[model samples]
Target: MRGVVYFIIVMLVASSLGCISEKIEKPDKKRIHGPKTKKIEEKRQVDSTRKRLGVVSGKWEQLNGMDGGDMHFIYSTRSGVLFVSHGFGGVWRSKNGGESWEIIKQEDFTDVYFYDMEEIGEVLYAGSNKGLWYSLDEGESWTKLKTGFPEIDDGTYHLVSLAKYKDELFFTAVLDKKYRNGRPGDGRLFVLKRDKTILELEAPANKEITVSAKYPYLFISSPYSGLFFSTDGKRWRKILDKKTTNVFVDGKYNLYVGTIGDWWYIGRKIGNTWKWEQVKIPGRKNTNSIFYFLVPDPINENRLWFGCGGVSRFYSFSARGFGNSFFGVGCWNGELKDWKIHSNYATSIAFYGDEKVKTSCGEATKYALVTVGRQAVQKTMDGGLNWSNSYEGVFGDTINAINPIKSGILSGTIVVTAVSGTEIAFNNGEEWMKGIDLRLGKEVGGGKLPGYPWCAVSPERRIEGKYDLLISTGYPSPFRGDGVFGIDTSCLVRGGRNCVKKLIGGPHYEMVISEGKLYAGNMDNGIDVLDLETMEVSKIDFGSGVPLIRKFDGKLFFETYEGKYLGDGWRWSGKKGKIYFYDGRVTKTIYEEYAINFSVNNREFIALTPESLVYKPDFLSEEEIRVKLPNKKYTDMAIAWEKGIIFLSTDGEGVFYTTIDELKSGGVRLKEFNNGLLTLKIRNLVYEDGYLFAGTRGYSVWRVKPSQV
Candidate 1:
């Protein structure tokens, strides 16, 4: 069955048993089965096919893992200079095969956010939100390309893709006429010849255009426009009229185009004629799958790798249930009767080399390095048979919460709960170590993993004179029940999963330890008090749960949520929220507003709403003041009381800082303080030792000195 085309139809059930033929007949239209029976039968077929193909499994490890953040594009030049671009994190270069990475910071390209990057000869070209950029010294520095595009800063043209045919470099620039208005625009192709001359041509489609080239053949795949081909780099002709998402030209010149529809068509040029086959992954029927990424095998030209997700080429936002039937990295060699499904939800990939290395599983070879969508950068040394997470020296996941150990032997240490698991930083904010086992990757049915650690609190008390940590786990929609778990800080430094104990069961948005008691503010249930000595539990209910909790000057204050749930960490739905002062006896609603989270100091209480921050001074005084902020949704806030500084994190924008004295004098100037950060989607913030730790949505934890800002 190698190198054969098989048109799979409904009656191709026998193929699941590792048998295949040239063609399959259609099923009888009159035949029908019950929903339950049909589902079971389909599962059986999929299981059989996957088992026959020896479903590749391994523990994934991160490579070039320097808190690289969420990757937008990853490409490696022929000379082995790997470039990975993070939209706001800037572009990073790894010369030693991802062993270490450094951000490419240049004077002229500080704010340039690259969407695509390609190398022609020794010059690297990048397409950004502003304009096109080129680097001559392997990304040591960069210079903007002077293409005479209209209003480069005003978003007139956004270069999205780049390709090369012979000696000429071709690029696709989307003419974004709306600019700051945030709307889609048309795209066109431009040719950059060796003589520094530019030639413009009409693109096949207006938006969502992609270009790929391999020597004599250059192809463009545009969603809703069709696949186009060109040999001389100027004139083009349509090859397939399908809603294509991407085009991949293998080393052998075999063309593959992925579509958004039911069938994926593989286009192969035989002689002067082109042949197309509607192919499917053996056994499974992917009626809605988006093959937005494709890469040829570095060692084998026949094998084609792919990445699947629900994102559409036409739209920027992810559409649910569109192409989510399969989400991961997979490969198809055309010669095989089945596809080789690899890692999970990888949007981009880059090969290191074709060298075969010795592995634990017999004599296998190392493969590629892939960015696993805000999780980690993974590498497969033994062809995906076994894997391990390579997060050493890399901070690539989202940091959900940060806890600074103020007491005990691990004092001054910063412990954080990220998207992957728990990490502890003992040396101020310089390095991090994953020593605690949080059981992060435990599956919770429906093909979903449990929620990550949302909050952590380190108490002064110790067990066996060793440091301990109490972490609460939860997300917007957690697959498992949220609860607080305690773990010994000394275990699992060298990869062990023991020394963990569940202390309490419930979703806790905020937690604080006062004296010998731990007060946790739950979103579903009301406040729960746990005595550190006896581990006894007590509940305080005032008709609703609290979204925010604090311990100030021997007093417990919490915010009650009489609003809708916003599907986040104890998020206060914009309806109503009241901060109450709890004195261990009675509760008083001191301040009421539409606040979600807040930070407090000795003088005033700074509350964060959906739109801006609310300042209440004079010990919960009736004066409710609204501070001005940029028109961005704020998520979390923190305060350095001694320094009189306040920090705010946004959902889209980066971190903003202001002084508390400025708020009192009605001159609060909230300024953005993101200098070395890579991501703008800040999730939470905390302050300690003049360093402000920002937990971003994708880039993990980035710390900045307030004095520098």
Candidate 2:
């Protein structure tokens, strides 16, 4: 009896092994029988460079505890490596899903951005604001593709699309007419054949372009220029008149187009013509919604997953959007009646796995990962019903403001507020974590003034090993009425429910703490003085609205701005460009007129005007001393008073520094001081603890000892 059972088990095992081998030899021949389906399988075989592994799943945690600002593209390989290109933050890679990430490469050219990426086997290609780049060996290193095109490295080509049609790879770039050598043109499209030769083709316009392949036919969607298609690579024909954002083709050869501000919204190709399919999104109208990207389900061809956002013109004064949020992700199962949407802005989507999983609501998807703009990467398992932020090991963030404590138990701790909210670094920015919990409740405004921590200031005193901070918020809607909140460091460790508390509500832009008073600047209101002893708030009208206020040389100096109000329903006239000096009792105007930014050293005070840099010996002096700078727009300035040097951060020309005495003498030559910086487009600068910290646009934050410069 035992021998008979063993024989039966052996026979069953052999039968299963034979079936597996047979299935591999003769794969499923299921085909999407639609128009122009000839040679579709051959094309699929040619496009075998990308192989997907199992779904990426886990709790949403900071990928390497950093924010990679505005992710433009995301790709994954069968070897389990993930890649993401932050438009300004540079390119990042991860081996273990998103548990951690390391920057593999950044644009050598200043202000250029990597906008799109494509994976072909072990090689990867990227399109950028300037030109094309390629990486071999799984993105550990990269090199620019400068062959064939002579001017590819000129920074004029805004390469927007890198796609594959049939077996040929192609890229499209928008060239600015101002840099096109008097040529009346929009953009260029280049194709890389199997033999590596390049062919130039005419593109519709230089605007946002998306290219997709549907067997033998190729489709191109250009915003504002409509949609075009071609059977051959050289010639194209316009088919649609509406502005389109993206193009997608499913397994059944069905064509779908994402439109921008179109009445027909989403376009679907049916039979031989295009049909408008309106998938009603909740709380959104056709005019305000934008279907950004579309991808077909691998197992369920009828189901389509899409990424969407709102049009730029859609502004909400209500509590929900407060201002505007063009962000959403969802799926449509060929049903116009219902769809699922998760509110977030997604740039690209990739799928993995073949296991069918359904949500409690009966919605299903295999496995998917999406790269959301600014919010970084996210993943979903049970379709679009649920999603998690998979941004571990990613660090493409724009540091808006940075504040460091000088002494006490939290002495070495630094707090940085950025596009991804607030982060606290206990070890001087070596590692960071989510800092404060802004109890933004639920819904649009979250019942509180929904905004981000703009700038934070702490009292010179600490209690119970806890530091208290008066953190100011930014982008406050007029409907909410305030942007100031307070937090204690104790709540940061305990994860308390009310980690942040509202102090004073109103439009405050900048804040400074001195003595027992907190001076806050605003756009609509003048300056707000909040007394810590009495907790009473009072206003100090500085004629126009004060946008900048700082404590320099033991006195307060602020700049007033003349600009129109841009909040929901708020209105303000304007004020002249003026800088004022404020003591605890009195205020006086020092230097007025078109000042961009100002700083002070131990010798004198310097202010950057639209035309030149001006210096004055006394705070109340009328004598004008000027230092003519190069034709570069200075965005921010910082002064290391102890070092007697002033640093100016420009929009594109990196950073320049000079001695304060040289500027006063009117013969100062600004010297470049960007030795260890990643990006030259520094947005903000801070000097603290003998280190000059630069908050850049796409490269997170950098700090260097001032003495080294």
Weakest lDDT window of 10 consecutive positions for candidate 1: 1-10
Consecutive 10-residue window with the lowest summed lDDT within model 2: 1-10
Taking the tens digit of each residue's C-alpha lDDT, what string does model 1 give over 1-709?
0000001011211100101111112322232110121111101112222212211111111112125344555677788777766544456677877766666655454435666778778888887776777889887888877886565434576777788777788888766544525555566788888997777777656666778888887788777578888777567888888877667777667676677654466777787546886656666555555655655455644445566655432344344333453322234445433345653455566777667644322233356666554434555666554444433344445556666544433545555666556555555444445433344444322244445566556666763333366666654544555666666656645544445566677666667676667777776668888887788989887677674676554356687777556554445235677777665666666656657566544535677677655666643455655665556677777777776667778876677777665555444556677665556677777666655667666455666656631
Provide the overall lDDT of each model, using Cα atoms, as 2-decimal numbers: 0.58, 0.57
TM-score of 1: 0.78
- 660-697 per-residue lDDT for model 2 (tens digits): 65665554566677764556777666665555666666
Query: lDDT of candidate 2 vs native?
Result: 0.57
Q: Candidate 2: lDDT of 118?
A: 71
RMSD of each: 18.5, 20.5
Clashes of each: 18, 13
